[model samples]
Target: MPPKVQQKSKEQKMAAAMAGGKGKKKKWSKGKSRDKVDNKVLFSKEQFDRFHAEVPKMKLITVSAVVEKLKLNGGLARRALRDLEAEGKIKPVLISRSQRIYTRNVAEGDDE
Candidate 1:
């Protein structure tokens, strides 16, 4: 007599599939790419003029704020804020060894 051939049950087949039979191996993902930063280390003449004119007019001024607005380096922004304060264009609202904040000098009035 021939050996009896057993058939797999539906549950058994499903279990085998669930076990990841014939599944593809995990691949190495390159991951999401980040855009390159092109921050300016030095300012052009026009940018410097714009920075001097518009920055003092802003309601809030900080190193990071200036950096984002003009794409400037942090040290450059800090120096700029210092210069503007010296020029009497902006008045310091907060001062500390770590950070400083400034606002437009309203008493000076708006002058082109």
Candidate 2:
């Protein structure tokens, strides 16, 4: 925020206190925030197509990556990664409760 705005607010508070009413006491607050929306639980046809086509070629693959790229829910991205791994288009590098990582299957090309 600009220093001038803060100065103005401070001046106003001082003026208010001098006018006989105690100025609004500073209160604790959860800092800056934003309204969040739920992730999509289902995929559109375009997203599905893009997922299958581009994901396999990506240098790194993870649930969060898919969710961000496809605007999918965590569960959906997890399941998609599992399915792709099962299909052998991507190879799992690690699997854990916190995260899963995968890489492109260089053994195969776009024969389909």
Per-prediction TM-score: 0.66, 0.71
lDDT of each residue in 1-112, candidate 2, tens digit only: 6566434588877787899757678799989997785788998898899999999999899888888777789999998889999999999999887989999998897443
Q: After superposition, how far is residue 27 of candidate 2 from its true place, in Å?
A: 2.1
lDDT score for candidate 2 against the true structure: 0.86
In model 1, which residue pairs have backbone atoms overlapping below 3 Å? none
What range of 10 consecutive residues in model 1 has the weakest lDDT sum?
17-26
Highest-scoring model, TM-score: 2
For candidate 2, the per-residue lDDT at 107 reads: 84
* Candidate 1 deviant stretches above 4 angstroms: 1-34, 110-112
